[model samples]
Target: MAARAKREGVSPGELKGRLLAEGYAQRDHPGIVFRGPWHDRRAALAEGPDVWEVASRLRELDGPEEHRIAVLCEETALHPRHVRIAIDYAAEHLDEVLERIERNEEAAKRSRRAVQRRAALFAAVPDPGGRPRA
Candidate 1:
């Protein structure tokens, strides 16, 4: 953080806070955080929380945005026609939407890993996966 703060002309605390707000987590050491790209496209869509939740879950669907939106609306119990505006908006901002979804998925994976790590530590169980234990 000191190195990054020196490069960015900000204090280390400021850098750490900024990184934490941007979904970064510590790497190598407790205070050392890794910075990565984040796309916050939710504000651009102007949809309700339900719509956002549905849209986030659509990342795993392999198809065009329209098809994904249709499936998402059906699964979320939202009217498909009512969310057409959001779907059209998403189509226009496809790249940003995809980036946002990818970032969300990456964050979820990190969260799962953290939970598993904590559980393993609590249980005193070594990793049982084929890969070498950390």
Candidate 2:
């Protein structure tokens, strides 16, 4: 915070107040009081608080902005036509529904490696230990 304030040429008090008003947490010490989608684990990660963007897009859907599934799909940045798709997938793959898409492709790479290692261990008829077997 001190570094940020200095860089922005503002006082910590001013910055903190604005952040608090914008739904960020307050801090007594100079550490993070919120978690986020970025490096700071303390800054709050924004989910679907994009009501303004959602409402704007919902205006393009049928009738009023309060339409049921269409409005909800729009609010979540999902296509209106994708609503039924989501419904079916939710029924099938509900366990993974809340996974955030912003997690980098690198993380998926890590998971793939882990799954491969587990499969190798299960195979047990080991050729070499370090890399994948043919």
Best-performing candidate as measured by TM-score: 1
TM-scores, one per candidate: 0.48, 0.32
Evaluated at residue 71, the lDDT of candidate 2 is 66
All models: lDDT?
A: 0.56, 0.45
Which ranges in model 2 have alpha carbons more than 4 Å from their true place?
Answer: 24-45, 68-134
Clashing pairs in 2: 34-42, 34-43, 35-42, 35-43, 35-44, 36-43
| TM-score of model number 1 | 0.48
Query: In model 1, how large is the Cα lDDT of residue 129?
Result: 70
Whole-model lDDT, candidate 1?
Answer: 0.56
Q: What TM value does model 2 have? A: 0.32
lDDT of 2 at 13: 92
Once fitted onto the true fold, the runs of candidate 1 whose alpha carbons sit more than 4 angstroms away are 1-41, 44-47, 50-54, 62-70, 125-134
